[model samples]
Target: MSTRAITGDQWVVLRVPISGEGVTAEVAAFAARRQLRYDLGDDGTLRITDPESARVIVTVRWKTLPPQVPRTLGFQLPSAAAVDVLIDPGPGLAAGRIAAALHDALSGRALAYTDGELEGIRAAMPLLERYSAARPAFDNWALIFRDHYLEHSTGFVLAMERAGIPAEWIFALDKGDRTWNRERVHATFQARGYRSDVLDNTAVNLPHAHGDELARVGADIDAFLDAAHTAGRRVLVVDDGGLLARGYGAIGAPRTADAALELTVSGIKRIAAAGPLAIPVLNLARSQVKSRLGYREIADSCMRRLQALLPDRKLIGRQVLLLGYGTLGSRLAAQLRGLGCRVVVVDSDLPALIDAAESGFTTYRTAGQALAATSPFIVVGTTGERALSDADLDLLPDGLVLAPFATRDFCALTENAVHRGGASDIPGVGMRFALDRGRRVTLLGNGRSMNLFEADSIPNEGYDAYRAGTFIAAASLCADPGRVPAGLHTAPADDAIAEAGLWSAYYDLYAAQGKGAVRPPTVPAPRLADLPAPVPF
Candidate 1:
């Protein structure tokens, strides 16, 4: 040996706190190939044991950065997790990318994974530490469930187990109910013309859900809230109404700041008051949270909201067709009915159509069946399914007042219809969801690939790529190489690249440590040969 240095070798332990076990193989595989000795640290830390010498240097790989830019989690050592990676102002950057890579390498299969951004309430502080005799974390980290996808759950579990993080601390409880926070089902957008169910309720209503009924609903909500308050578990509330829908309305804990998730907006003060709380209230409409100008959502929002200012002159008055009355459409239908417009909700589902009818909103099965004035009012498609037709357009003439709020083509059907039906290609406007006025806006653009039918209403498929990346990173870290707390990680791609870049800079700093101490890039991160068992210290 030509006097190998001890600077770049150690048993890297990754305490992956996820629900699945994979990506572990990748770390090991990578390490094996690079001939790096990796030891799995069971006590929530990846212990890289073998170096050329016994002298140790800690590298801080705090979570939160790097979809490209690594932002620091402000990890301090009142009892710091081991680290030497920070170059004075290290950690955080490029971390997000690392996280994404890890998640995919590990639990990519399951986990309706999306890239999360771990935003800190405090100023982007330096990684200061309160040392407690060289140990791991002093405060326990938390993990919560956001959905019931078995893949996510399994992947999370597997990742955590493989990382060798203790099981007791990582909770993985799933909300047994599916409709807990479903938006489309509970009806968030449309609020005018009635649905069949509302019609049915109105048709045979002995009385409205009130008085004693309201009391009953209130009690149930209280019970749910009480349970959450007592637990203080940092839970991931995972129902699909874009993330908030307790129809007939009874959300537990109006004071929603508990460790126990399903945390509602009600308890903001209390929740925020409880320590350094990181509230990642899922922006159901993130598909629209951006832009230089105030956010612009589907034109319909302007149409619907017009009621508050003009009250009677609401957008509902415009001729409109409410398609797919699940959660997204139902509200749109109601909103249309409010604006004094002739509204017809078309859906194959008899019950939904019936609900639409009940709500004072007319219901039709298909666009074909409900053909009124060809180019009637605004044709807003809500179902994440198909598109519109040319025949339907022929009647409406103002060239189909349209808005596509999806990643895929809502106008696909109509696009095809135009092509198939041999009519002049009259394309609909595309809505781009962006952030504006501090809230979000869906900006309607000209093209279709990046911005048509892309939801301003909710963000289901919108964040899949980023989420996928985080999952990949987390999983990779969980490998016998490295893993960090999978909690509250806000990984923006910008942050990920930043971290790597920072790492490079830090390496340079380490080399120039003054006094003529010179060195080349610290040996590259060793590759894993195979997913290995946690090597003992």
Candidate 2:
């Protein structure tokens, strides 16, 4: 927690003479701003870098209170850096605090990682934040998931849910999500088995405002309003308030509640009073209710969808770095390990490292340590910070930095990370892969699947196909999930539709003939094997 680091994992910068500008000083200064702790007390050697990303471009033996046997060590400080890396600090710092510190360390500062270095680290922040976030609220309502995970901490409510009551569970939503989240519904249901026919009541009993119905309901609306006024009606729904005239004729109920919890208040209290009723109404807008509910089905569906989209990355003789070990990272690790990847998880949060460790993830507190040991197969950032630094960029290995949360800062950090002491100029291309009918079958029998595998060969219940399709869909959204890669690209909507259509065709193509479905396209025969192997280059 207190930045107490273990060593042997040092970014050894290959030394050049220090005559002009003490590069070490610059490095030290940059690090100091980030509040990195280090002391340059050695045999004219300074070692600097986080445990995960430092390269030791040149390794020199530094003498700390004690001297070592090797008068010198051979390694170079890494100049190659990714924009994002995991940080490890004592229990004192929150993720937000650390991010602010790093931003100040580099922005408008001197002795910072080279311009190239800064860009690379910034590139991966948003992605890391995503990974660093607590478990996401489940939204995929169509699948099964663990119920307790999506619960909103209420015993009475949870009890009703587990009892299979036809209870309509709802939650207030001022916390910014607009759509009804399926995960919340599913989780609650899973925890408490309910014979619930889930419905979206936010738009209850009214024509959609955008459709022609709103206009149609308009002129008739005023007539209802006039009738209510003439009847001397006053809206009322209370147990005791002495006798008073109550409004009986109203055209429609209020469309939306002013606040989330208020939505369930009035109607729900009445329903609850009807002890042991079959159709129970749980008021979600009762102020203290959670903003969103969690549900098992939603969780399962999301998990499945995510698992489907995730590429089964393998270590199989490759080096790799896993930036953040929060929920996303945990899932990613499990999947990758299944694919035979050697994973090492890094995080600034001690609890995170502990979680990963307990879960059997190779946990690390710093990027510098991971870098000192080996170049990774891939560098995946999950924390929501610009973790990489100029010093880090100057020493990266030749590999890909997969950012699950790519943003402008993330792109810039990675784009400008110092490679070989300077900014990288090798711009990458954004490419897409689809199961284009091949003369012969393959991931790219003309096009690679978004799962990064060929169609049939792509494992995991056609997840690759779905991913491929989503790439096209993402492209259509002009939403570059990552940097505007320089090469080929898999657009979002186009690819998503293709994958969807393919799956539909695979199952229903034959049904078009007024019967059961027929098999769509079969994997081509092996006879065309000599036809150029889908242009891997």
Best by TM-score: 1
Residue 160's lDDT within candidate 2 is 21
* Shift of residue 510 alpha carbon in model 1, Å: 50
Note each model's CA RMSD in angstroms: 23.1, 27.6
Error of 2 at 500 (Å): 30
Worst 10 residues of 1 by lDDT: 123-132
Candidate 2 per-residue lDDT, tens place, 28-132, comes to: 675666555444434454443444544232222322222212111111123222122222222222433443343333222322223232222222111111111
| lDDT string, candidate 1, 90-182, tens digits | 123232233333333332222212212111101110010000012222122223233322222233333332333334433333222222122
lDDT (Cα) of model 1: 0.33
Model 1 RMSD in angstroms: 23.1
* Clashes (N, CA, C under 3 Å) per candidate: 187, 124
